[model samples]
Target: MESCLPILLHSLCFVSLVLQISYASDSISAGQNITDGQTIVSAGGNFQLGFFSPGNSKNRYVGIWYKISAGTVVWIANQENPLNDSSGVLKLTPQGVLTLLNHTDGIVWFSNVSRSTQNPLAQLLDSVNFVVREANDNDLDDAIWQSFDHPCNSLLAGMKFGIDRAKGLDRYLTSWKSVDDPSPGDFTYKLDSSGYPQLILRNGSVVQFRSGPWNGLRFSGFPQLKPNPVYSFGFVFNQNEIYYYFNILNSSVRQMLVLNDNGISQRLTWVDRTHDWRLYASGPTDECDTYALCGGNGNCNMASSPKCVCLTGFVPKYPSDWESMDWLNGCVRRMELNCQGGDKFLKFTNVKLPDTRLSWFNKSMNLQECKQTCLRNCSCTAYSNLDISGRGSGCLLWFGELMDIRQFDENGQDIYVRMAASEVGKILAFSRQSHSEDLELPLFDIITIVNATNNFSDNNKLGEGGFGAVYKGVLENGQEIAVKRLSENSRQGPVEFKNEVVYIAKLQHRNLVKILGCCIEQDEKMLIYEFLPNRSLDCLIFNQEEGVSLDWPKRFTIINGVASGLLYLHRDSRLRIIHRDLKAENILLDMEMNAKISDFGLARSFGGNESEGSTKRVVGTFGYMSPEYAINGLYSVKSDVFSFGVLVLEIVSGKRNRGFTHPDNRLSLLGHAWTLSRDQKFMELVDPSIASTLNPLEVLRSIHVALLCVQNDPHDRPEMLSVVMMLNGESTLPHPKQPGFFSEDSVSEASSSSGGKHQKIRPTR
Candidate 1:
């Protein structure tokens, strides 16, 4: 009996070894399964293919799960079509395809990867991806096909999530139908690479949210995206494909990109000590993260309560509807597109960039060549750099309306918008004509603005602009000047040059910027202007420490000084011009807080008896444009009046109108002050930095006049002359009405424009 027992044990051990060998061998065929419930773990133990019921469900489904974690399913072979009984078999065909057959039903699930080879084997690699290849091909790169190309809700480390242009097959991740069901759901995550690579989360055809375009470092839309030691991101762009993939930098950290049931994506990693996954980051943090919340050609600032706004060239389509918080309609262009030979391009800087779906690209063209190409093609509406790396080369042009534009403090791309050449000429003539008025600096003997900027050092940078950057310099003469050097391959061009010269030369005022001279030689167009020691008004008004130093006396002096400056333009200047773009940043401060308006890139001119005029092309910033000017392309001194009102409120509060959060109401500073002044609580609206040190009567008077100037109806709003007179107690101010975009409730009205293709919101340039 003992001898018989030894023989039985030896036979059992040999049987176990044989089964292990069969499992690892490539000859095991599919029809030879023996059990009711079974699983085949890959030879490398990286993945397991089997049939299992999810949660407590009675129905069974064939799936691929992690071998290390049996419950962690990565791919399901039959998610939507589940078998009622456990009679399923997963088999690889000779044609390099995977097929799941059922005993009860003839066909269950199948993977169809077309291959010419007759002898094929299915294997799971260490990356947990299932692949099928020719049995004779030792080179894994020659895989006949792979399941990783078609992902479910999970994005593995090396998987490509983009379109196969040749096959028109777009590989995207669809969310699980439910928490318990692994079936596909309405939500899908697709890599939109039409213009750039941006991860868009969509519910059916509608976009639920978006991850801004992938900048050189990270996604531009997500400011929180920073360097993480756990993973590294890579973007692949070529003629055939555009894909975004990530690799685990730390082998010890197991991380996954998962689209959960509620549509939140979390990049989670396992923590050994905690014995659980730690959340690294999540998307859709704020309202602005939603796809095109504000509308086309709009900018969004999350710091502000009502985060959506139009860019400089657009206005609300339905102003009343937008004021009601229905932003789906988006905004309309204040300036009409004539598309004539007179059309020009306006450059917007430091922006996240609009959607590039209807755009064309060229890799070798410079900015000048790109502009010429776009100008020749009337269909081209805008143009920008295809790649913003290494001094920025390549060109991308947009046809039709520019949509979904947003400003980012970091990793912003430049876009040149189409406008009337006459309009552009008006802007160019200002700078160009003024430039020649002064003695021209010698061509070849010019000092690079960078050298003047101390080798273009960041520490020496005076300020930045749409054209390029400004640096304070003292050219050997010990005479200080602000050098405006054009960025390499910048959007601003000769037209902008001519505009600056023509417009600024004819105008003369103590409160206006004076052009000393210019250097236009060898790809460089540098504007040399009289350097103001105190710098821009934004440097003082928005700085906490600097703002505290601006006492009531100083604030009053600045208010009066700015008023006089506007008065000179509206009533005193020979041209009777309208500074379409009037904002805190454009107001230059001298040694004594005296204000000087600068940057006429967007300003428009008017002749005698020109109280009002219409333009097909509207150009100005948001939060300052009057309803008529922003919506109907109508402009006059009244437009400047609205801007002045906004400027006054901003200076007094030391906060930008774009991100201003109303405490008791969801209204802009102009609107909130109007409400408060109407209720005699205007003093509460003063900036805390200057509140304690301001004159109550003067501040109240200024606030009242500002409100009167920002009235919803352009006619109801006081002109710059009346506003200045009221500020100086020379005229009695009238009661103000509800300002455009003012909100009475805590729920502010969303901007009328959406971040979609058609509607765009113009910003206060």
Candidate 2:
């Protein structure tokens, strides 16, 4: 052999040795072998297919990964079958089949294909898909097979994750047995198509989590699936196929959704800076995400303390078990159903619709027709709009007891559950109203509420306001709640209730208080909210002892938090809202002392291009009202900025705007703050309680921004965005002009900015 190599250096054997030793990072022709030391990269150099040993494992396997991030495997070809040594060879046959051979030339793994072709060639494309097709043909449809069709744990962009019903071919993700071992694990994330198609994560035969049924927008339980800059996603269910796919929008970004060895499905994105993967999102995030955590006929809420409760018409089947927090026993109907004649359907809103495996859906039926169909069929337990898109059409009906029910504060589909006729009348006031359909909030029963608050005991009362008396309550399941009972003598009535429901039900943010449910029965109108342990800002700032508890850092946090909440209401919310009554009294503090804005009863929403609205009657707290809103009866997003400015000054000084008096002058808090700002003595306005713990610059900046927000001219007042920027120290401050309502002039006798008094609150013009 040595004599032949020197004499005939350009022989076929020499050529074969060159192919084996040198790297050929592209397509591999038939009869060629990519041995252990050799690898092939995609045409665009984004992906590379080669032999890899993950982690501490000695055994090697064939896989694909991003060339930009080494060792980050996305797809493993022989995950379940690893080679014992480096003698492994990956070969493509003329039959268009790809085979992995061991040292003995025995096949370790081979691609399964129904057909074969001549001149077959395997090439790695930039999309990360390794395909085997005829060398002359490039179309994917005509190819024999592809690695994407048999995914191992990784679901890359532009790959389908469902079943091709026509061909009975299913594509899914499976977890690795261990980090060091690439063999298949116990968990698999796949699309189940028993009735409607929903994503499910399972541990062998046991179901761990379900992604709820797909409404046109997103999976019901998956709120993290929102619009993002990285990718666009969709689910398709046609006669031939049913699958979910995501296409990356930014070509420079690399991402994949994978089922990890721990059975958690996570979406990971490659970050160039870190040179590693970032966890974009993951499923089964909380206890509510547990499959049927509350069992059948029960509701689970994350914000609520105990997190589970029976549906309106149901009660715990085992009282002792429920008291012990063993909710697996579930709930049962309080009254017997009198078949179709004596039963009525009660609508449950903002909820993860129950398990769809025991469900049936029709594409042609409208919502009204869907309700009627459920009524006629005695076995039908519930029904909802199958597709919640456009005006919403199609029907999905659930039979037997409902399971896996959960409640969300916003963006959830509605379902109508059957109940006894007697139980339905108690909530008829809400269901019969035309506006009720848009209030995407749950409904609480009078019986449960009455028991929780001990029939509105004054001892349990939290506070009283123009709205109503608020009583704190604890449900049978140990969930804490705050109930606001409307007074019979109060002028605030239905309009205020509707405004609060419509606005807060659809609005979601960390800085906003969450409404749990509402009660309209037994001659009562009430709203239920999550119980915040720290209560309102007024409760603390007005009290000398409690005020000391709020140090400089906490006060600054509250000020910044209120500004962000107001910014969300004015600009970032689903609809543009003008809060006419944003004051320190309406700012609530949670257990962590983080602030959340509350009381949306006087909030007004404007549609697109309609920035401002005018009203004949004006109503708001006197000290917090802006000049334009108080006098001209015109309100805009700037009006809320004015109130926020007042709040900021009050928080810093530990003084209330109304009934505030300076020892040397008749100036209110606003006038005092403006004087301090004008003199460059803003540090004098800092609350004495926080004097020892203050940052002089932050305090000065807060005072400066507050003056700008309270400027007399609406145009002079910065928008909430600018207010936020100034508060965050992101933008330089603009000197503020004269603030509104600074003098001691009588508001009753209108002179400049103050107008004639309004007869009532929120009287729609």
Candidate 3:
């Protein structure tokens, strides 16, 4: 018996060596097989394919789990029909089919196969996809079958969670029945293709939660998926497929989206420190995420005491139901559509667009065109930009009722909803009404402003302007504010004030000034803004001592910010707004010197193809005025372009365009710039204060762009969009023509006066 024991030990040692051989081989041929004690690891040894039992369960299943983190299963093969003993075998056939067998060698689970490969092999990729393909052809597209097409509870990096329309294959995530059971559970997270591709989570056939449609940047409702250091993600909608996928940006972090047994969808990342998984983020985080919680035409806000409220121009469909906390009926319009081309759209800012099941989209349409198209169709209930990316593009219009609308604190979207003319009138008349606090806009009272500003003390005063004096104020809650006191002498009446309010409130861009609320009481009207600590652009560029700090990069940033703001106004916004008062003082600067275009009292909105308007009363500053606008009373988007050119020149030279005088030449700033550009000495035009930090190429390009902008002919001037491209591009530019207001050494009052109902405003500090 002792002699036979040594022979038995040698046999057991040989068996253990055979099992260890399986761990290093990433791929296997048709003749190869893996038993319960053996396993196959990925090429990089990141993942392993083997047989395993789930938490406290005796039943075993063939699954894929992280090789680095033991017992953390990701994908399962025989989840529904598990083996009771350790007799499971996973093998590939000559037909390129992957099969799992029981002790009797009867196949319990098998992968789907379309066609047999010439050299059949089953390989586990580092991307976590188990594929059956030709050994000579490693291209993923040529694979006959892959485990990625059938994802289970865990969605690893590079996994597509969407559909392959032509092939009729839907790739999605299904929760496990329980921690101990690997069967498909009641919850599924998948893309719904009814209208747009929005992620929807369901408990059987009933929706449990929803991720709003993709808006170019991120999911409109999934703000949690923002710029992060760990991963980069995006949604793809092409002719062949539509899907959402994320890649681990940092290879050190192993992350996966898991739909747990509890029906909760969360992003999990493996933490090496704790040797366990940590929750990165979760969806349907609050009540507002519940699908259609407030039903159609209702806007949900978790910050509000009662989470749901009817949209403007709408009322609770059933008031009693709303009172009883049963708001499923949603809202109904107080006034029906006056569809004789009388219905108008009321813009709702900072909102999550409603369900899009009954919607149509145009990828090439502008916001103005979208508004007109919605008006043309009486059935259209609302419209918004489909792609809210750079400068914004595409349009999405919803028909019938808008459902599942919610409000976001930041990065929210703006949607235009159809409304009766009378309802629109009420909104226009809101400025004259008493103080009211609303979701879209808020109103501050006279007493609050007085208290905030310490009764208009000189110490709190920021600066005085044509509009009025600017005062720095701090609210009781420690929020700093900038209050613009509209002078009684200032020509901006309630109507103009209301227009400014409506425009600024609806406008949401990084380059535009953000208005908090307003004060309209005791015959006083004031515009409240988020205080900018760095004051105005004029302070930075025109002050000799302060101007030295602004290097070429900082100056270029200001130029780009202003250009982006003007571009948004002219082309991206719902209305084409002409910022008639574009001047140095009107440009506010944050602590980082980021420029924001403000003072919209003199701004005009042009609808449809109306590019220019002639006003008998000219407004805006003298030196910044364009030739056509200052002389012929013609103001367009080009006028703003001309002003931007003047601003760029001022920033470069550290001089004011209105009073600039060169030692060598008695030329105006425009004339001096033109002379420099023609002589190929544009770099000489840069500010002496920034001589040490100037980029000659950038300085030359800026001067050339300025010359292009201040051209005498409005026809010769490039549009703001083109100006942006020219500044940011290295393409050959067209030679600039003579400037309109750059005549000789002297300035003319008549030409300056020719540029308003009330002329020239000095913006507040």
Quote the lDDT for 622 in model 1: 65
Q: RMSD for all candidates, in order, please.
A: 22.1, 7.3, 12.1
Clash count in backbone of candidate 2:
0
What are the per-residue Cα lDDT tens digits for candidate 1 across 1-765? 000000001123322432343344322232334223455556655565656656556677766655444455667777788887767776666565677777754777787665556677666665767677777775766876677777777776777777767645678777776656778877788888766567788888988776656545555555555567877777776667777777888766676677765676766665668755566667666676676777766666553224555544466667676566666667666567675566667655556666666767777888778988998987887887766656567788877766666655334566777765432322222223233222112121254445656876777687665567787775432335687777775445565565555556556566777664466656777776767787777778889898887777887887887788788878876567777878777887766667777776566666655678887665556666677766667888888888888888887877877667677556766667777787888877788877668788788888888877777788898777777778988456677888765753311222233111121121111
**C-alpha RMSD in Å of predicted model 1 compared with the true structure:** 22.1
Can you list the residue pairs that collide in candidate 3? 617-756, 618-755, 618-756, 619-756
Task: Rank candidates, lDDT, best first.
Answer: 2, 3, 1
- List ranges where model 2 is wrong by over 4 Å: 1-22, 424-447, 466-468, 493-524, 551-577, 678-681, 691-705, 721-729, 744-765
Q: What does candidate 3's lDDT look like per residue over 116-218, in tens digits?
A: 8777989989889999999999888888999999988878889888999877789988888877787998888888878877888889999887777899988
Model 2: what TM-score? 0.88
lDDT of each: 0.65, 0.80, 0.79
**Which ten-residue region of model 1 has the weakest summed lDDT?**
1-10
| Lowest lDDT block of 10, candidate 2 | 1-10
